[model samples]
Target: MADPMHDAPRASITGRALHVFAFPSLLIAACLTGFLPAAPAFAKKPPPPVLTAAAAAVPDSYSAAAAKEIFAEGGNAVDAAVAIAFTLAVTYPDAGNIGGGGFMTLYVDNKPYFLDYREVAPQGATKEMYLDDKGNVEPDASLVGYRAVGVPGTVDGMWEAQKRFGKLKWKQVLAPAIKYASDGFVVQPWLQKRHDYAARSFAGKTNFDVYFSGLKAGATFRQPELAETLKRIASDGGREFYEGRTADLISTAMYGHGLVSKQDLQRYHAVWRDPLTADWNGYQIVTAPPPSSGGVGLIQLLKMKADLKPAFDGVQLNSVPYIHLVSQMEDRVFADRQQYLGDPDSYKIPVAKLLDDSYLASRAAEVKADAAPGATGVKPGLGDTMPERAQTTHFSVVDQWGNAVSNTYTLNGPFGAGVVVDGAGFLLNDEMDDFVTKPGTTNQFGVTGDEVNTIAPGRRPLSSMAPTILLKDGNVALVIGTPGGSRIFTTIFQVMTDLFDFGMAPQDALAAMRFHHQLIPPTTIFYEPYAPITGDLADALKAKGYKLEGQPFNGDVQMVRVNGTTPEADSDPRGAGVGAVFPLSPSK
Candidate 1:
């Protein structure tokens, strides 16, 4: 099944740009070979979403190109997804990773699947792992060193997805990433800000400057060590990362500074659990479940929003009343989030009771048109709670065969724990910070947690990564997800409502103004600076006792939807990413 140019095993890189190899040029200067018209930038607001047949929408163009390559070789959505995931590790190290872990939602063989590959606490982990002798939380103790890392699961997750439904050989699917890691890819100008930020924040705590110094914009960024690691994984499958040489490197790198060890790595495995699916407004909704509070929160928001104004029938998009109404739904959910959700295997998550119609109705009945109940106003009805990270990435893929995959993965922070394995060349996740390091404390994203989600040996932390798929009748309607820590499910709820209920085009919905409110700090509201609320609307919310602030950006969503059986997708314009469709057509 190899292309003629790939018939022989050979490659050569010329300087920092040109290359003479089958897969080399694909990751070079022109990475969007199958991409459509240029996606809008965050500078502009309400850019319409563009949908095309057999598409892939990702956080970076190189990753999109990798998906395109796999599709060209007759790979299914899952195969293309594997290609995208690994390619991201090479091209978008901040989020796309093999060293971290996340969740996945898939539509295969007319059914739904949810994969929980979230990282887990080490065997040595304890509830007070990040607390000091005085019972105070240690600053950056769970966010900036080897002690921050948990056992990673991305490798096993990807392998499980491929093993169950992928059509291409595992080695074949991993080739593009290996090639990119070995030959290097053109560094986009957009990465400079985040690159600079990482250097400054991690100056003394990590080896970031030593390992990532070459990430200057417009350069050929290569990771030979990472390529070698990928080669071993490709040759031996997922076990290579969990039990072979890569595991040894990770354990040695941690030595006396971290809790992860060879034993922790060997015990890691991805889980295939039933997806959370529901029917609302004639659409079948499917999303991530328990260890992740996303699906539950999403459904609750949808249910609460459904009860408001009878229907979204006359609600103007972003109108004062609309923002007020949606904020009410959001503010109530945090109480539930902080009380009744955590890893199903470690703690009992009251999923069914929390999602029961009677329960949601009771929660919905409490929503009011006035301002939020101020900080500490809401409480868990049934009781319990959890937290997680924000520097994450999401991608949506739909192959020509009606197979779709929506995935979101992260490193707990940009570049993860800031610790890159010396010989491995990948970042380790600070996912341990996702747990309740101390009761009633907030993590990097400022979401408060309780003991229900406390650290435990081998337990997966609570998460808000909501990779989701929606279906109309029996056909796929939408595949979507994003990264915003506490802002995730709320943002996803708004976008999906825009597409289905408000009739906003895909890009407009993706690029539209975004606003967020969390119960931890109930009086403050954060909206994206790009597409913001600065006029009477701001005054209106102010009149309602809300203090508004502008964040540099909002959620960067990667979304795909069906248009009468044809696939279409658009990456968030607020991000430096791309949306592409294979078999390009002039009309598109």
Candidate 2:
């Protein structure tokens, strides 16, 4: 009869902050003696030794710990996922949010579900709002300021998922997030870059400085305003964000500079859609559907690769031949995405034909291992046409009961529209830019689109968030997703191939080098720094008439591979996050 959430074990902010400067005296002595301090002096103390059946991997350590705590509190995979999603809003501000939207692909009790909480354009939104008199897309019009924000769906989406599937109470699932925002958490070193960028770009003009200007590494950064905002939602419900006091703040904040209104917030609702599921060899792949081009693109790319199996028989993972073949597939997939995918409610996408075998086979035949797609960008298979941040966050979860959740959410850009609601403390998403303001113009991620993704009243913009789950023989095989704007689907494809096809360990697969080509500029391929292309491989690719570029970072992928009963997990080292089998005490 006792309350469970309050009874859950959690480290207090002061207690958690103490570990930041652990062994302070020892550090001074070591400095005085000219001896380097040991690893324990700076590294975070390890969690308890108990092992739980539930597992989670997240893009931030604070959110990871929150998931562990929720598992220890007897929450199911859905509950833990809902908890982590909220926790990230407090700790990973660059992408996590209540003021943004995203997609969630869940597998519970052997049934698959996909939730589209993608932000929708305001009722006042218009296709020509961002175009100039000469028809040029205005600069920074959709990238910054208030007009860029869409009506957020994250809070409602998480709430809908929990209400339908989670075992824990809604308020109980949100307790950890509320506490973190009010009491604070030790800021990680990775936050500095985002904080500095927001400060430099917006500063006093947009209120970015009011919130994050004081953020420092290893400091106990607090968000009292966000804390209060979360408390209101906990006491009320997701509706608190849509129709209550929080809604007022959001509308007031956008009174002149933005388009979202109190009406838009009240009208916002999340959708539960059938996941796009396909059979690839023996494994079943499940992912996001239209509105988000990722699932269709991912399945098509995989199918094309399968159809052209003979073309890549002898190529290595990152070899020139393999890269060429993959790029060929990617170019086609991206082309299909622009022409055939969009918000399903508004536009009927050709999902069946896009992933049909006949279509895939025809697309595969065009892929030549010996050459690139040529100087001309590939055209969509439909009529020969088509058309999303690396600054997003993703997390994967699986509980002892076999329920798994692969969730990816974002603010459309780093720190979103770079403005905060005056009284409510969350950043609004720049998702309006996700739409093609003008046919040929690019958004923040440098991806273009056609009318299929053009802005319209209350229409959801197209996205590339591909939170996916792979299954073998009716059991969960892999729970994977990542945060990369245009690079999202391509990055996920690389990781999936490495983990499933190449037989690599979880960590190695996530840490492996990656390549991406989204067909916008079909002649160029981007590769990451690890095991980079330098010698013969680089030459071979160039000889194929493809230009090579080094992207210092790829995707921050979070994954959990089910190996028998054991959960093999790893978070991308590219970002500061943790991936481990959270020790769940049996006694709980």
TM-score of each model, in listed order: 0.88, 0.89
What tens digits encode model 1's per-residue C-alpha lDDT throughout 1-588? 322222334433221111222334443222112111111211212222233457888998888889888877767789889999999998998888999999999886566767889999999999988889999999999988899999999998899788767877899899999999999999887776688887787888888878788888889999999999999999999889989999999999999889999999998878766577777888878889878998889988887787775634576788776777777677778888887688877666676666777777777777666545463377776643342211688999887767789999999788889999989999888899889998789998889777778899988898999999988876788889998887889889989888878879999888778898877677778888778889898998888778897776578888887888677778888888788878632311
Give residue 390's lDDT in candidate 1 (0 to 100). 10
Looking at model 2, which ten-residue stretch has the lowest summed lDDT? 13-22
* Segments of candidate 2 deviating more than 4 angstroms: 1-52, 203-205, 372-377, 384-390, 583-588
lDDT per residue as tens, model 2, 165-269: 776678889999998999998887778777887666665457777777657888998899999999999889888999999999998989988889999888777
**Residue 407 displacement (Å), model 2:** 0.3
RMSD of each candidate relative to the true structure: 12.6, 14.0
| lDDT of the candidates, in the order given | 0.80, 0.80
TM-score of 1: 0.88
Please count the clashing residue pairs in each candidate, in the order shown.
9, 8
